[model samples]
Target: MNARLVGSGSDTVVLAHGYGTDQSVWDKILPDLARHHRVLAFDWIFSGAVKDQDMFDPVKYSSLDAFADDLIALMEEVKPGPSVYINSEGYEGGFDISEVEQLLSSIESDFHSWASSFAPLGVDPNDPPSVTKFQNCLKRMRPETALSVAKLIFLGDQRDMLDKVTVPCTFVQTTNDFVVPNSVPGFMAKKIKGKSTVEVIEADGHFPQLTAHLQLLEVLRDVPGFDL
Candidate 1:
């Protein structure tokens, strides 16, 4: 159960990558953050986990809470409370009031923009988005299945944990995000009721690690109270 760790400094900062992208997504931003703070980044189970797999089964662990539970457990072990936390496209909970969810649900009976966020994996930073890859990820997934995952992620009510988290967090969000939308981070900033910064980095795609590395790094370098 060895977790990947990076950076070394007194001021600790952690970055959690979204579903499709791995911890490597933070490669560009790490050097910047590492300049001042101890940084930790890890891949969630479905992506760059110790053991990643295709298709997340709801029966085994069930729900994003399971992944979040593991994250909290791991964070407690590595860093009790970070001076800053960068949840790329992960955790669409508190301070989350995305109109996208409402719009999606209205148009289709089944809509899971949060879960289907993995779709952006088609766009690699090195390669960017290929028409072929984008069509492939979506080609197999049905609207109902996509919606189910999205609902689970977007509707994931983790407001309870927000009060518990005493760390200063900086949520770097995208402009027209689907799951972890601009509003989600905005809602979180106000609701978290702790020291939290929302850096609305305008870029294409949901995964900032791939689309907006420099912008993300700027947020890390200039984060309030964090010297890193």
Candidate 2:
């Protein structure tokens, strides 16, 4: 459980990276965000940047709840309490089981090709260096580890926990998001326990923090607690 804190401010912002990527994806928005509030970003145990592979327990991480527990622990240790919680990829949960199974199967067979398919609508699909870098990091994991986490992420359901979440949530959904559909955020806003808003940016791609930083920054600026 290692994390890095950026910026110096009264408020703290937690940048939580989703599956298949590391916290370095947030580099684009970190500077602007750091100017306003403290930013805390961490690499998940399965991440390539994680030096301590011992922290990752396959059985414990077999479910999404384990990842959520890690985030909660990071927040409690770093900031000691709650703050504006921003999550990438709507975990409100929506994915066809067959589609997920097929994708996972494909990723297991050809990881690079599978990774290259997620390039945004307007981005060059000729396997950009960004995609290469992303693939390189993910390539560090064993095929079984990647597939296991992917199964948990794409096939697992977490809508039941939506009602249990009492924190303020801002679902930053990107248009043409290949991983999580555009509708998940709206579904999340309707089901979450506390105040939750869906901010759909006119950006495409799964990793908006990397591909659509400026637009993401604008959307974050208008988020309820991030208006700094």
Candidate 3:
């Protein structure tokens, strides 16, 4: 649950990463963002960065609600005010239980193969170093943890929570995300209670922040409140 607070400013922004990767996913954009605002970045224990086993309780992490609660707690402790939540696709609203379950099953069966498949979908497949680095990152994730977290995502329905959200929110959708289909963003945009924007970026993959960092950063900067 430890987090790194970077930069120095009166305002605060929290960067949340999604499944299969850790806080480093935001590395491409952190420097620029940190120059103007304080950025809080942290790794979920299962993210493989936090090695302390005692920090994670298997039973507590069995659901995404637990993760949501932790996010609120982190915000309350650090920023304690209206904060922007820049989440990856699946972590936000608009998820189909069946589709996610199948994807999870595939990942559990072959983590490396499934992880590497992103290249063909739009990632830099030809780059040996980046490919190896991504593969190694996936390999660090235990299959059990992946399956458990996936189940937590697929089985959980967060639509009600969206109705409860009162802050200005933005959902960034990738053009060619294999895990989350094109329909998710629209579905989420309609369900959210507060003011929200669903931005469809030209990036072509689930992990656009890693594969298409510049384009993603451009889209993020243009987001209403995150222009900082």
Task: Write down the TM-score of every candidate.
Answer: 0.64, 0.87, 0.83
Give me the candidate number with maximum lDDT. 2
Tens-digit lDDT string for candidate 2 (1-228): 458888878788887776667788788888998897888888888876777666677799997778878887777677634466666555434456676678888878987667556432223234376566566666665556677787777777777787887877778777776666778877877888889888877765667777777888888888765655
Per-residue lDDT over 1-228 for candidate 3, one digit per residue giving the tens place of the 0 to 100 score: 669888877677788877666788788888888887788888877776667745667689987768879987888787635555667647543346676666777887887677676434434554455456556655567767767776776676777776777777777777776557788777777877778788887765577777777787887788776655
| lDDT of the structure predicted as candidate 1 | 0.59
Candidate 1 matches the true fold with a TM-score of: 0.64
Candidate 1, residues 1-228: lDDT per residue as tens digits?
235666677767777764334566677678877777777777665552335344445453457667768878888887635456677565554333666456356426533343244354334334444323433443344454444455666566676676676666777777755545456777777777678877887776566665677776666668667674
Which pairs clash (backbone N, Cα, C closer than 3 Å) in model 3? none
Q: For candidate 2, what is the lDDT? A: 0.72
Pairs of residues at least 3 apart in sequence or in different chains that clash in candidate 2: none
Candidate 2 TM-score over all chains jointly: 0.87
